[model samples]
Target: MNGMERISSFIDSYIEDDEGLLNEILSEAIKNRVPVIRKASKEFLRTQLLIKEPENILEIGTAVGYSSLYMSNYIKPNSKITTIELDEERANLALENIKKLGKEEVIRVIKGDACKVLKTLPDASYDFLFVDAAKGQYINYYEEIIRAAAKNAVIISDNVLQDGEILESHYTVEKRNRTIHDRMREYLYKITHDKRVCTSILSIGDGMTVTIKLSD
Candidate 1:
C-alpha cells in the first residue's frame, strides 16, 4: 500500500466512536466537500487542549467551526476560543453552528484573512493554537503563531504530512500541486529544525505536527 493508504489504516485502527453528534456533523460536511478537521485529529486536539486548560486559544483556520466546538465541549469552563476564517459563507455557517450549539459565548469566529487577523492579537498571549488553514501558508503562519503563543504553549498544525505528499520530491508532483508540495516540505523542515519549538510529526490523518513552545 501507498503511504497515505497505510496511514489511513493506522488512523482507522486507533480512532474511536467519540463525540457522536460532532461525528455526524463532520460526516455531513465531508459529503458536501466542506472541509473540517479529521475526526482523529480533532479528538487528539480536544484531549490535549483539555489537559492544557488554556485560558486563550487561537485557531488559524475555522473550517465550519467543528474543531473549535469540539474543543469547547471538552476544555475548561470560561476558556475562550478565537477562530479566524476568510470565507464569508463558511464563517456564517460556523457562526450559526456556534449559536445552535449554544457555544457562541465561548467560541468566537473572526471573519478575515488568518495572517491579517493574527497580526492584531497581542503577543505571547495565546496558550494554545490550532492551525488547519491553507497548506502553502503553514510556515508563514507558524512565524506569527509562535509570536502570539505564550511560553510553553502548545500549537498543533494539521495536514503537515499532506497525505504523504511531503515525502515526494516536488518535481514528481503535478505542476499545479508542485507549489503546495514544496511549501509543505519547507514548513516541515523549518518546524523540525527550529530550536524554539519541540516538534513531532505524527502519522495521523493527513499527518499532524504537534509542537510545544520552549520556555525561555
Candidate 2:
C-alpha cells in the first residue's frame, strides 16, 4: 500500500462503531454488489452531521439507501433526509430498505433525475447536501445545488478523483471516459475557485470534497 492508503488503513483500524442495522445494510449491499460510501467517508460524514446538526439534509444519490440510513443515525431524530435516485430499480430497493429498517419516517426516497428534481426544490432550504451520483453531471448539478443550499450549508461530494485517474493527461484517458474526465475537472475547478463556498478536496476514498456555502 502507498502512504495515503497505509494512513487510511491505520485510521480505519481504530473505528469500531457498533452499527446495528447499518451493518446489515452494508452487508446486503456488499452481497448485491451495490456501491456504498467507504468507511472513511462514512466517518467523515458522520462527524460532520454530528457537529452541524443540520435539520434538512439532501442526498443526491440513494443507492439502496445505505448512506441515507447511515446519515440518519447521526442526525437528530427529527431531522429529515431527502435522497434522490435516478435508477428505478435502485430507488425501489432503497425505499424497500428504508421502510424495512423502519427509517422511512425520517428518510424519503425520491425517484427522479436529480438534475430536474433539484430545480423544483425550495431555494436555500437544505442545510446539508451529500452528492454521490454521476461524475460527469456534477457540473450540471452544481448551480442548482448552490441555489438549494441554505446559507452556510455543508456539501460533501464523493468519487471526484475517479480512482486517481484525474491526474493523468486528458489524452491518456480512454475515449469513453474523456467526457467524464473533462466535466469532473471543470467541477473541481469551479468548486475550488467559486467565491460562494470554501472547499477542501481531501484524498479520501476515491477522493472527496467538503464545501461550506458562504451564502445564498
Candidates' C-alpha lDDT? 0.84, 0.92
State in Å the error of residue 186, model 1: 1.3
Residue-level lDDT of model 1, residues 27-73, one tens digit each, is 76788799877767776887788688898999988878888888887
Please give, for residues 48-163, the per-residue lDDT of candidate 2 as tens digits. 99999999999998999999988988999799999999999999989888987899789998899999999999999999999999999999999999999999999999999988
Model 1, residue 177: what's the lDDT? 81
Among all windows of ten consecutive residues in candidate 2, which has the lowest summed lDDT? 14-23
Error of 2 at 52 (Å): 0.6
Identify the leading candidate in terms of TM-score: 2
Q: Model 2, clash count?
A: 0
The whole-model C-alpha lDDT of candidate 2 against the native structure comes to 0.92
- Write down the TM-score for model 1: 0.92
True-vs-predicted CA distance for residue 148, candidate 2, Å: 0.6
